[model samples]
Target: MANIVAGIGWHVIGAGMAASFYAPIEKVKKWSWETTWAIAGLFSWILLPIGVSLCLLPSFTGFYASIDPHLLLTIALFGAMWGVGNVSYGLTMRHLGMSLGIGIAIGVTLVVGTLVPPIMDGKASMLFTTRGGLYTMAGVFVALIGVAIVSWAGHKKELQLKGHLEEFNVGLGLLLAVMCGIFSSGMSFALHAALPIQEAAKSVGVNPLYAMLPSYVFIMGGGAVINLAYCFIRLAAVPRLSLREDLRQPGPTLRTNAALAATGGIMWYLQFFFYAWGEANIPASMSYVNWMLHMSIYVLCGGIVGLALGEWAGIRSGLLRLLWVGIIIIIIAANLVGVGMAYSQ
Candidate 1:
């Protein structure tokens, strides 16, 4: 019971961290997406992760060395692919608005993040052969229903906002968001494949909670590399990126840039922090549920915050109610996933 409580708490903390991540980006002024992403990458993908791993994981070096080079490379490559998704997610949010953007992204993540790892591990049968597996599969279907509802509401909202909201571009945003979900969830498969690193950490007497850091470092490092490349490419294409003039005219641009970078860095790392801790509390058989729970909470919190921030303002009351209904469906889906995991254990 205590462990379950801890798992729930950590999951909530993880969700909060994810929710707060993009808030900082809204603060960044004058800088293009390229500059902003580069700064965020430094904090999120590089400095912060290193600092945490060094501080928490005592056997970091030994464990890192013990992993197979080929496996590590594969994980890193997946991270790089996920990085592209991450960049696209930001753009999706900008174009789609929070409710629709997150709904679509989570839909993709739910499918990929939950199923891919199990399939890769050759446990695809577990999802159907066992009663618990059946429940989980059911939960996934229910969750998809919720996502559909949320997305439908978002679609309606977007239609209503067409004339009022100048920045609306629902079509492109939804497309990119779906792509983001698929690739972002790919990270879970990467982590699963790097199980050797986790074993190495166990052999070295490191706390299981901290042992996961090294794997994250490698994975996030890959993501960082890809995002850095993309940023550089954007920089090259846009000569204004070289302009010192924007820097000179900025108000809170620099400050916002620094803050966003720090926030994004910390936010990115917190997912694993909670994941590692949550893994400690749950049975290994249920690890896939962790991703579902984490992503659901993230989407829920982001949606709620978006509402609070007036992002959904001026929409009809009927539309707002519909959105809430969608949120409820997502909640049901998350609960089903959790229940299925518990039953499996």
Candidate 2:
């Protein structure tokens, strides 16, 4: 019971990290999106994963020596696809605004990432048979409802702030957002596909907390590779946003921007840093639900971050109240998941 509670706590903390990572990037000045993103990606996806892997999984050469190349390739390929999702996620918000875009994106991620892996693994029936798994599924559905409420509230808030949504194109934005969700679920798939690596880590006596580190190398680093490719392409296409010149500039501007971007990078990496710890506590039978729990908390905390940044400024009390209601429901939903996991354990 206690372990499950701690796992939920870790997930909340991880989601909070995910929610607020972009703050530092927002403070970055005069840098193109590609520049800041690439730098942040180094920390979130590549540098940090490698650094932590060295720390936790010490015998890097030995670890990979035993694993099949096919598994690594499979996981990395999924991670690469997930990289595309990371990019499209921003575009979704650009097209649909925070509320509706987030609602749809997170909802899709919750459903797809939660169900697909188990179905693929032929363990879908366990979800139905296990009382705890059923409760967790219930919590996921409830979280989806909360997500809808929050998204609706955000849509209402936007209306109150602006006369109308500037990016109200239903056809294009909706399709793009759905595509983003599908790709976002790839990270879940990557981890699912890397189950053998987990056993290898255990065979090598790796601690539970650190077992996921090596997998992150293949997964997160693989995603970073694609992101780097995209950013480099954008940089070449737009000479004005040349990251080379930005890095060449001397003094505080470059240093300050780099520092801010790096901070954001660290913050971004912490999402999964904490996720590893959180999953260590989840019951194996109920583990498939972790993605749902994660996406659910992410949306909720994102709403809280908006509130903190005064994004809801001058909002009508009714919509504001609706946002609060949704926030409450999400919190309850997270607790319900923890409770269900407890029973399953």
Candidate 3:
């Protein structure tokens, strides 16, 4: 019970970090989005991960030597796929806003990430026969319903703001959201596929808490390739959007924006840091439920933050009511998953 509580706490903190990751980006001034995102990715998907992983694993170089080349490539490939998903998710947000993009993409990610592994491993029967499996499954479906409600609220909000709808493309946004959802599940798959690496770490006397650190190196490495490539491509296509000017003549704005972007990236990386911690502590029997819990809490926290930031301000009362209802459902689903985790333990 104590371990379950601790795992839940870690996931909640990770979710909060994820929900608030964009706060610092709002402070970036006089920097192109491409430039700032590139800097942020340097930290989130590259430098910070490498630095932290080294701190966690003193012989990180040796650890890589121990992993099978084929397995490492497989994990990296999964990360690369997830990187595409991450970019698509950002595009979805551009067209759909926080509510709809997050709700739809994360909903699909949670459901698919949770179920596919067991099915692929030929343990589909466990989903029905295993203790707490039923509750976890219920929680997943309920979470999806919650996401649907939230998506509906977003659509209604769009209707309320129809005068400003010229720039929004619901169809494109939904398609990107679905694609993001499918590919985002790759991260979960990467972790599962890298189980052998984790086991190797454990055998080498590495603390179980930090065993996953090395795997993240490959995961983030592949992500860095995609993110950096996209940012560079954008910068090249629009030279004026590049950070060359900012770099050549460093100013207060450049310094501040770089710092803000780095901060955002570090915070973004912390989400997965905490996620690994939480996942490690969860009982193996119900560990799959962690994805659902994380996603639900992430969306729920985002909804709360969005409300606090007045993103829903000046909205029609009906739309606001719908948003609150969706949040409540998510909260309920999270609790159900938690209870299920406890029962599985």
The candidate that achieves the highest lDDT relative to the unseen native structure: 3
Between candidates 1 and 3, name the one with more favorable lDDT.
3
Clash counts for the predictions, in order: 1, 0, 0
User: Considering summed lDDT, which 10 consecutive residues are worst modelled in model 3?
Assistant: 93-102
Ranked candidates, highest lDDT first: 3, 2, 1
Residue 296 accuracy (lDDT) in model 2:
67
List candidate 1 stretches off by more than 4 Å. Answer: 57-63, 118-130, 239-246, 249-252, 283-289, 342-345
lDDT per residue, candidate 2, 1-345, as tens digits? 998888889988998888777667767888887888899888889889888877777588778877899999999999998988887765665555454455566665655555666678898886778887787688778767876776677556555656455555445555776678778878878987998898789778899876876898899877888888988999999857887787877778999999998998999889998998899997886674465577667777766666666556677878878877876676566666656666755
**Candidate 1 residue lDDT tens string, 131-165:** 87787788778767776777777778778777887
| Candidate 1 lDDT (Cα, 0 to 1) | 0.74
How far residue 80's Cα lies from its native spot in candidate 1, in Å, is: 1.6
User: Taking the tens digit of each residue's C-alpha lDDT, what string does model 3 give over 1-345?
Assistant: 898888989999998888777667656777776677778888998887788767776587887887899999999999998988887776776576665566666666666665676688897786788666777678778878877887788777777777765645667777888788788888878887989988887887778877887688888788778878887898889857866865654577778888898998888898998898898888888774576568778887777666665666788887788877876676677666656556766
Which sections of candidate 3 miss by over 4 Å?
122-144, 162-169, 238-240, 245-250, 330-345
The models' CA-based lDDT, in order, is: 0.74, 0.76, 0.77
TM-score between model 2 and native: 0.81
- The ten-residue window of minimal lDDT in model 2 covers 163-172
The TM-scores, one per candidate, come to: 0.88, 0.81, 0.86
